[model samples]
Target: MNIQQILKISADKLRQKNIPSTALDAEVLLLEALSKCADEIPPAPFLKGGVLANDAPRNDNKRLDKNWLYINNNYELNKKEEELFNNFINQRLKHKPVAYILNRKEFYGYDFYVDENVLIPRPETELIVEEVLKILNNDRREQACLFPTIIDIGTGSGCIIISILNELAKNKKDKIIHNAYANDISSEAISTAKINAKKYNLNKKIKFIRNDFEKFLNKKSIYNSNEIIITANLPYVKNDAYKTLSEDIRKYEPKIALTAGRDGLVCIESLVKSVLKIKKKYKQKIYIFIEADPDQMSRIMAISREKLANVNLEIIKDLSGKKRIIKLLYCHPELVEGWKAR
Candidate 1:
């Protein structure tokens, strides 16, 4: 009958469903239904002080109904809103991520289309992107003319590489000569990545290749060193790792996109070794940015060091200050001409 009454009903339903962040979920679902961003929704106001649908001012009435939590808060949901809200809750109960249900995911400050084919992009991956951008932005030698080639390994949905281009193209539209590459072991994942790329009209901005990391490495016999920047969000979740994961993840997402291997370093091991050999051929340096499980980093670094001698290694931490990205640089002492550290 009122906003307070509707929230009570929805919140109770969510809690009973064992949904974490029940209140927040209810609020978001309702706000999205009305096509209103979270900021536009009214905060919980005075205890039961809000007006009813009919009695409330007309402008407030429409906005209020969109606030499904306020159902009867100040407006009533028309049929369309009612259908959407119900479908939203049904999907959530089945453990579908909100982004998946809405067919959208926010990444690097932009909303990207999503579907079952791609893993929902996480905020953590953005840390790797940030580190890569930091190195590019800090270069004093002119970021404009230098076309920095970038490759995203195991590029699920192409989120990492695409986000980098999106951010760069947003600002320095001219420093855009570099080729962008995205590779995924799974054909389906590659399809998903291409869809997102096409949606952004970045088909020309990035090249999508359906190949495994090992295959790509084997194929990189003639790559130039100065022309490359490698970034990856490898599946660090150990093969033995999935048993411990929540049912929500273990059941829904594609296995190839999640589990790396027996030690979770199987693919990573191959990548490090491949880069080491490639550096010799290229003669410049490789900017390596990657995400690894907390415990796996030490082993990854050790393996990388063995393969890449004299490579400057820096560990990147996420916003929460957890080490998430490993940035490795080659040719340290011989910093190219006017260039320092990149």
Candidate 2:
């Protein structure tokens, strides 16, 4: 059959299966199938706005309008390629996420290896990386010039830490010598993270430590440096809410990476307490950046107050105008007083 016919039929099948982005999904699957079969796609027609009849209605019959039929009739797929494309379409119908099907996701302009073993990186988490980079570039700490240890807690897929390191490597002005660390509780996650790190040639630069938060806490001697910058996008989805997530996420992504405790504040709270303990033991200032649901702000703030009285805190909101990242500047109480008095 022609390209149009296959896409229409596959999209119709997906529509029937209640796929949200039927047309887009059909296009991606078909293109992926074509690339997989080593087909040299023509650039003349398909490149010049010949893929989809963007103006066509969503209904089945309307999907095969004149604009689409012309392109479809011109482009045809062979038997084996057609079968492969159909298989991909079927998988989409099964509620599998596109990223998992592709086995790669673009995060911070870099591709990261992902699968069922680790949580798929989301757009929202990009804000965490951006904020951390900003802090590193402009941090006014007395030890700022010294190379800081950049630690990513629960480093799923190693996207955040690797992306940060990649950006730092590109920054000529700073010329910083930061040590990178990827800490995760899951062996599977650490394995996947290391793969991505090596893909970007950052494996040697980053130290991958497979341990839960508690174990990492006990082995604090590794972080002997005075300037420490810690960032974590740990499991913050509530257990009950996790059950209600989209089918693709609930079925495919790692549950351990998506969920925490009842209120979704378990990991974040534990992280806050751990950072406090680390600060007390090392007697050094620590900069902590955490990503959490907006709803958990008050509870997180309450913990900060109860545990770290007189701490300097900043809440950063994402593009959606919801609070997403929490930044804490841990200074001595006397330092805090001096800054406030100034």
Candidate with top TM-score is: 2
- C-alpha RMSD for every candidate: 5.0, 6.1
Candidate 1 regions exceeding 4 Å error are 1-4, 36-72, 143-145, 173-176, 221-225, 332-342
Report the C-alpha lDDT of model 1 over 1-342, residue by residue, as the tens digit: 333555567778878877778777776677666554323334433424454433432345344434334434544455666567777877877777777777788888877777777788889988887877776665553633455678888898788888888877777742643567898888888888887888777888787878877678666532543556888887778877789986557656767777877888877788888887776756555678878876777887888888888887888777888878888877634546436444
Task: Give the TM-score (vs. native) of candidate 2.
Answer: 0.86
| Candidate 2 weakest ten by summed lDDT | 56-65
lDDT of 2: 0.79
- Per-residue accuracy of model 2 over 1-342 as CA lDDT, tens digit each: 877788889889988988789988888777667666643333323324544433332223222333443454556677777888888887899999888888888999999999889989989899888987876676463343456788888998999998888887787423464567899999999999999988988888899999987678657666776567888999999999998998888888889998898999889888878877776777556788889999998788889878986577889999989998888878766545755887
Candidate closest to the true structure, highest lDDT: 2
Query: Can you list the residue pairs that collide in candidate 2?
Result: 4-72
Cα lDDT listed for each candidate: 0.72, 0.79
Per-prediction tally of clashes:
3, 1
Candidate 1: global Cα-lDDT?
0.72
